[model samples]
Target chain A: MKNAKPSSRRNFLLTAGLGTAGVAAAVATATRGEKPRAAMPGATEGSGYRLSEHVQKYYKTTKV
Target chain B: MARMKFICDAERCIECNGCVTACKSEHEVPWGVNRRRLVTVNDGVPGERSISVSCMHCSDAPCMAVCPVDCFYKTDEGIVLHDKDLCIGCGYCFYACPFGAPQFPQAGAFGLRGKMDKCTYCSGGPEENHSAEEFRKYGRNRLAEGKLPACAEMCSTKALLAGDAEVITKIYKTRVVTRGKGEEIWGWSMAYGGSDKLSDLPGGKA
Candidate 1:
């Protein structure tokens, strides 16, 4: 009976280790290099505002 | 090893909004969201000048550091980017950014902030290049085409420049030294309060 108990405990530990590995593998597959979804599509595009030639010259001078 | 940067000439701005239009047309940017805008400090005055403002994409990006989910990242070229999927819409980046670069859309009726949005410097997001998924989430993938940003390309006066830091700085420096008086404006010291020499500015030293 003592020997039987040890075998059962060893089986349980092996199962737990495999379960942990399986969960980790599944998570890795799910999240491997997945791109995040955008909250607002095209939200960062420029609004249609133009700078005049004179203003352009000023921008050129001030750039770092 | 050098990161890219932007230097706007507040004095040269004409408020014509060419860069804004170019950006909109190139990316088909949706209404109510401005990737670039004109900010006039002194309106209706003799000294009034329109300054174009957008993501400054700082070196020590506060958005990247503050993100709880490690969503924000930087490109090899120094362009700051973030993963929209990982973002929790916490609004920490918006508060941390000095240039007010981060933006969020209202998702919940209670005005809860959604995922953050900001300029990508035309590089697109963390998806496969030019994929439909990338387009749906981020926008156009102009960097894949080996072209400069549309806003800079479409600048009627060539006011907005987007390129390698060294190249752009050389162009600006040539113009400044030639103009002499504009040197104060060309380097960051005069623009953002540093030294008069370009090498004196942070990241300005070679």
Candidate 2:
């Protein structure tokens, strides 16, 4: 067998492809089981009282 | 940090009672208690109008003023919530309310009046948020879930708008400006009277 390395173009493409897959996998793991982000600012789940995400949704619907 | 409020556009309401259903389902409210209701003016007439009615959560709530046991309290967001544990079921709040928001469920077979219940603006009562007892006593803590009141959200026609007073007022104003008419918000004058001095009217109070 030839003792030669792969072409630089192939090596760069392989590295880029692996790097993107690794980043996407990390993101998916980090976000797993976490609650969705609130649509409105300053709204937190399990609160006494705060402006809520539903307000944002309502605003969208009421757009005139 | 915004003061919560509800504004129902009478012109858009179809009297479908979807809001009532949503409220009931969300809270699993017991029988004979309605936290929200519909009121139609000039029913069966050409100029008929339907408006969803509930606790307006007034800035200076009359219910708070009249509660004998002092169970009523106002949140930072201006929501008027009462403690069922402390409520005496005297019905004074019910009588004092302009919209008749307070409701007393029949507790016993003889129709005994139970503790008062009303709209919490979907913020729930003083109980722990998202707890089973809280859900049982009040309704779903939609506010805690970063959601608005079910009745307003479920309104198919977007008639009922609930959120920060400024935001909803802006939405309503845009609709009014676009329509070029119906500038008179249905319950705004009654629930929250304007700054028009009585002396300025045709009849002089001064």
Candidate 3:
């Protein structure tokens, strides 16, 4: 009812760490048949872009 | 030159999952690849409401920014798309997306994550329109056909509206003013955070 109490920061950190490990495992499995590249971090920015008005409106509505 | 959007009116959503079915059927999205879903708050109570969610296709898309391989790109209509060829299955997009929009199929041996998949807003992918390759990679190109998204079209309660922002906002405004119960839900801060003056909140800038 209250949206699971907004998970604790510790829980979030644990989950993030576990998730990263899981993704790394998945990536390892994926590249088993192919050559593996060194892992890299995500990009910090993208080409300057914005959502259309239609997409913007989704977040504009009031919560029920 | 306006960007398209999808607005879900939580008060009106019935959680029939019609939108989910429509998306899966329209895209043949395969098992475990949920392009859309219903998130309900206050379940089984008077104030219980379900909101359909997918990729908001954010303006400063975290997925695009977080992709290690620069696989994502934006369409002229402001739809977010990605190239399967460039994807490394690292799952950074999944981690970065606020809406949990991106999904991956476990293909190859050892449960490897396959190409990232999500709602294309019915505009399809980077390939040429209506080609088999495009269909295989990105599903259908319904936008080029001048049709609305399958999810919105199939929404039994008309709760999910997808189209040009101006058009959908006008429709929502009319509904709100006519129904007279939407002022509190008119902006993101209030609906999601229970605060109308969201810009004043920590880490927020309206």
Q: Highest lDDT: give the candidate number.
A: 2
- Model 2 CA deviation exceeding 4 Å by range: A1-53, B107-111, B184-206
Is model 2 an incorrect, acceptable, medium or high docking prediction? incorrect
DockQ of model 2, rounded to 2 decimals:
0.21
Ordering by DockQ? 2, 1, 3
Chain A alone, TM-score for each of the models? Answer: 0.54, 0.46, 0.41
The DockQ-derived docking category for candidate 3 is incorrect
Instruction: Please name the candidate that would achieve the greatest DockQ relative to the true structure.
Output: 2
For candidate 1, write residues B1-206 as lDDT tens digits: 53556656565567889888876666666666677777888799888877777887777898888888999888877889888999888889889888887877665666587778777777788977655566656666665544456666666555566665655666666555555656665445543343467565344433
In Å, candidate 2's interface RMSD is: 6.0
Q: Which candidate number has the best TM-score? A: 2
User: Which lDDT values do the candidates have, in the order given?
Assistant: 0.67, 0.80, 0.73
Q: What is the TM-score of chain A in candidate 1?
A: 0.54
Candidate 2 C-alpha lDDT tens digits along B49-124 = 9999999999899999988899999888889898999988888998899999999997676656889999998888
